[model samples]
Target: MFRHIWIRLKFQNPDKRRPFYEEETRRSIIRKEEEQQWRKKKARRQSETVYDDHEADAGQNDGFTPTEGGPDPLICDVAYYARRVGLDMEEFKVQTEDGFLIDLWHIYDPAEYTPLPPGDRTPLGPSTIPTSPSSPPGPDPETKKKPKYPVLMIHGLLQSAGAYCTNDDASLAFYLCKSGYDVWLGNNRAGFNPQHTLLSYSDPRMWAWNIRQMGVLDLPALAARVLTATGAPKLGLVAHSQGTTQTLVALAKEQRPDLGERISVFCALAPAAYAGPLIGKMYFKFMRLISPAAFRVFFGIHAFIPLMMTMHSLLPGGLYGALGYRVFSFLFGWTDDRWDRGLRDRMFQFSPVYVSAESMRWWLGRECFAKQKCILQTKEEWREEDNQDKVEEEKRSSPDASPAEPESGAGEIDKSESHNHKASTAWYDHRVPPFALWVAGADLLVDGKRLLRRFASGREPHVRVVHQKVIDEYEHLDVIWAVDVVEQVGREVKEVLWATCEGREGWRIPVGCEEVGVWDGKSEGVVGGGKEKEGEGNGSGESEVEEVGRARVRPRSRFGGWFRG
Candidate 1:
């Protein structure tokens, strides 16, 4: 239980991951050690500047370029094709601060991407789309408008869209496209992208970013291409973990409001927002003093890729079986609790989990959790000056309080919302934005109860707050991997989407009513129409019974760690 709660804490924490420890202490110690080392090295180098110059230049430029291929100088990386099906020449690598980029393999086939149970007679993306949504789903009777909004799949930290490229199985894109939705996948800045043909880590510019730039650049760029190809006005957004954090920052970065409007809906898997998990909180708090550069230094010691998981898969037989088993166990814990032996097999079969030290640092600190709340350096919270005295006074009164802190760019600590009394909002978990369809127990990183209340607050009239009351499932990441779980949620989603299909005027109403005809018998026309029959109203914790009760295997995932809250 502690382990499960600890895992959940990692997601719930937004600011520093410090639960009760005097966070930042370790970072300071490490920083001091590094500074001393740098000073000693600098002094020594100055004493022998002439000889050192030659050595420094020779060492820095000694690495080979990736295009050259035989070997990579700056980083140790493995190159491989995706093992899953339904994908193209999709490839990826897992990088570590240690400077190793291990190549990963995947398989791309439709079966791999499609959720099991073969339900959802009507698939989602382009391939599965009907000639006319209002018309029967078959060959187009009329020329196609093709969906303007393709799906935009955002990969998690250190992961690339190629992560979905499964061998023999269609990639997530192909599945969605077959389901009748257009699909577009992309790599965030800190990922593997052939487009990044000319950057080298030895060069300062090759890798330095905050989450701010992701939404401002990465997501929009991909969205633009998909929209151009499909003439889509909007696209569905799907992200996991740190990928989800950057998406939120990108959406909230005040970039293209139109882009936000163009988003069909935002879906997250194993979503993360806070940094409170004991290991994670400490990791973030320690990062303050441990620069991204320093992390690169430490990472140089460990192999950057998750090859163990892959090796175990490709070599799942006899002699090396024990070794593979051990590696598999460790990799499975990367996303959820428990070893999940079955899940380990799947990991070996799929893509390796790549993690970016800097990207993670940016997420834990800059993106969602700030020193205080404001994820973005909202001007509303900055520009004020009287906070120092407030901090001092508060500090004096409550000896345990840490004086206020400023974020990366939010000049001097302002008390606007930073009263010492309130632990920085940065430390607090992100409250779900005003309008979002949160699939609870699916582990979006938001508090289920908080999300339930926020949407249920009776404010946003058009936006309905429908939650899946789970008698059994809803773990983060299950939305993507848990075949049985998706079956449960998919039913609810299809019915909701069916019932809420827009009309001629561009409005979506609950199903059953003429304007809103596809409702799953759960939707009532009026918002929060609880007075309707028990099973008739939508998302009021009903209907999930019908969906979950029908699942086969009843297995959580390929892995088998169950969380009973």
Candidate 2:
């Protein structure tokens, strides 16, 4: 924690001593203006407007006046933030198979789409499967173009769908909506407004799940809702951190492998599969050292740190944001070096949402992911595989060397190897969708590079890596929160989504992606594909601006770079 603080202090600009104070002043003025305009628009709509589809569509862009600065510190609403950016958000309550009601947010251009009425915004039951109307309900097909292809985005741990909306125009959800793709932000079960069909907040059954339930239940429910709402056969899946973890588990053949068939492409940002160096930190180690009963006693079986949520409601937004950042930095070693510091307060408002203690245990307890390191394999299993790889590599490097004679029990060893290979080799089946990974090279929270190498080798034969890149300067959150996130991650994601889209003939192509050709399944190679340049910051308390020139700097050609099949 002290080290992180020192890094922040060391990297400070002497001229910008009052940056936050100045930003607060500017934000206050802009927010007041925006709220006034929004009120006037709302009053006009309420007094003069009836439900007119064409009129709403036509006047959609009229009321939106993009704010000049960061979001308001007082308002934590996603819809309000969306309206400030000339986009609108509609919320839906989607119930998982386990009866937990999760929030799903849709972002759309107000000029292009009509908002759903309040009466139609009720919770969708577990048995409910939305179907398209047999007859046209809105505009005529001949006059109106087809809807944009849907993209479902899931948030990381302890955050709600609002995480994707805090960055204003540069927010991934808004960017994708503006780019002409229908964007749906999915929250995991028990978010800010935890609800259940048959259970109350006090019921332990309401919070008895872990990531397994999230993968097999919550994620599928959200995806189904997005596909059903858009009437698309499949939607692109974009996930960050813990979101990526659940997706990886869901796509595994032993779990909800069938869910992959409904996804066109999986874009994993800061993909979390293998545990990183941060897992060994004191707090995490403490969690790992405790027994399950002790864990339950400490965290409670219901909510994980319910006090955080209480504090979120009690504290002022700026104070909460400041304290939240400090606490998270102490826990995870994240710095806002790459984030838009002006909007950092807004970003924190969407996180530290309601999460179950059981889920936290699965992440950091003595017997689950923290112990295993790799989500699907034990340390011993993966280590054996790594040793085998080393042996094979040595053999290739020395073809002329004599082969060693078989030792006693070699037959038993061969049988063991075959059995272990079958058990640990593949995580996904042929039903899995194409994967495009944006790895944070400097992210100490997850070992994304190891996950990439797992795919690059023939370990997961069923998986096809359509695109891959390593942003050497990025930390875990930078994939979404970074100021240049659009250029570094969003643009590539847009292209990859368009390229890997299987049935694009019927869908409206996203902006900046019209010229992107369908991936021929040949661009599955590493970016740079060489050793890191000497003196580059490896995400270890280095100032991001100092390494800006080296960030995402790919080689000019593949002549000297490596490629994967």
Candidate 3:
């Protein structure tokens, strides 16, 4: 029933699901041997092919290394997750203008079905009823209806499509798919699966680009492919953290207004602009204030932060989650409630993929916030650049002072200075798309209020904030991986996507929506204290809390908060 003409269908029998990863179980060594045999046969067949000459020439000349020995056995993505959970997933590849082969995963369920029993069959239902006597009759009821509206989810910095599927049933991607929407997960260049048609992994050219390329080329290419495959004119977008930053770059900084017209609505979670309050300010200072070329000089051109993959690959599944939590919380801020500790291993499997050193430098360099030139720029970059002359002047005046004092000068960095005026102005001028903004109250990585005031409450609002919700105790990753995300964040995202698909008119909030908190410049305080019941237990036999009726609930300082649409 779903027509996908443009998508390259590699798996003819998607229903025959099996584990492809070598280390999925203790018998992985045997699986690896079987995979080697398959690769040898494939290579022999290629050698015997009539198109071998052309293919070889193309691969060699275009810097396509053809995965060296054989294609990777395991793909860490939504498709792999779907198969593990008894769902069907289709994999597609989109080639950007810059030659990066980005991976795309789609999970779809058909609407048609056979009658349950012979005697249960009912008369054919009418497809479309006439509005009046003069109106034309509808098509046959047996004819399949158009496919469900498509929804595309993009991930944040150091993450892949897998981020949206970490919570399985409760994840944003799975929830949308279960809600009868065609769900597609998008991967940026240099993501978990970093392959390309014309660039070899060994080639520095492959790792030369940054987030600018992502906004200018990758997002647009993926969007176009998804639209063409789904036969939909436009689709709904949900992005988080740095994902929101690049979407804005694609729409505003790159001046791709056409991309804006193609997205029905943008639901942003923890939008990553104005990062003066970034919890890992010390780490960024070590990178920017110390040396811009450190990553390249240290890691080489192969990949940035390749250890992330090593950690996932080497650590035991049970142990990795706890260790990963500590590492992530140390780098980003601590969330009130961590992702279900059970999910930490699976969640880290696809994240912290290969990013370009240039991209990292861009975030840590002179043009970060001042020019708004790249996606995911932080306030640290601006302060380092802005205070450079002053620092040099001080050094000359106090030549005999201890160098340690200047090196550890955290005093100069102003916590309140978000410095997002230029970026905000660009969004206003470019007419940024309407948004359902999710403000993470305890997120120290970015200043959420600066972003809200910039686009939502200006003298003339350029970007319409149709809906805004503040999760009082949430942090960066908690928006996606919280235990109660389904009732809190996912529900709102579902409603926003459904409303957009239904073609609702301008500036309208959904009925039965209750305001739980208000953003008062600095922090989002819960103005209501009504009690609420929690969901069923996570099979741990822990005491289950009672669920309260729809009401404004206050956030627990030690626990977390909840909101419903």
Best model per TM-score: 2
Candidate 2 vs candidate 3: which has greater lDDT? 2
lDDT of 2 by residue, 276-319 (tens): 99999988999999999999989999999999999989999999
- lDDT for model 1: 0.37
Instruction: State which candidate, 1 or 3, has the greater lDDT.
Output: 3
- lDDT for each of the candidates? 0.37, 0.76, 0.57
Q: Candidate 2 clashing pairs?
A: none
Report the Cα lDDT for candidate 3. Answer: 0.57
Write down the lDDT that model 2 would get.
0.76
For each candidate, how many residue pairs have backbone atoms clashing (under 3 Å)? 78, 0, 3
Per-model C-alpha RMSD? 22.3, 9.3, 19.1
Clashes of 1: 78
- Please give the range of 10 consecutive residues that has the lowest summed lDDT in model 1: 556-565
Candidate 2's C-alpha runs over 4 A off are 1-12, 15-71, 127-143, 399-424, 525-565
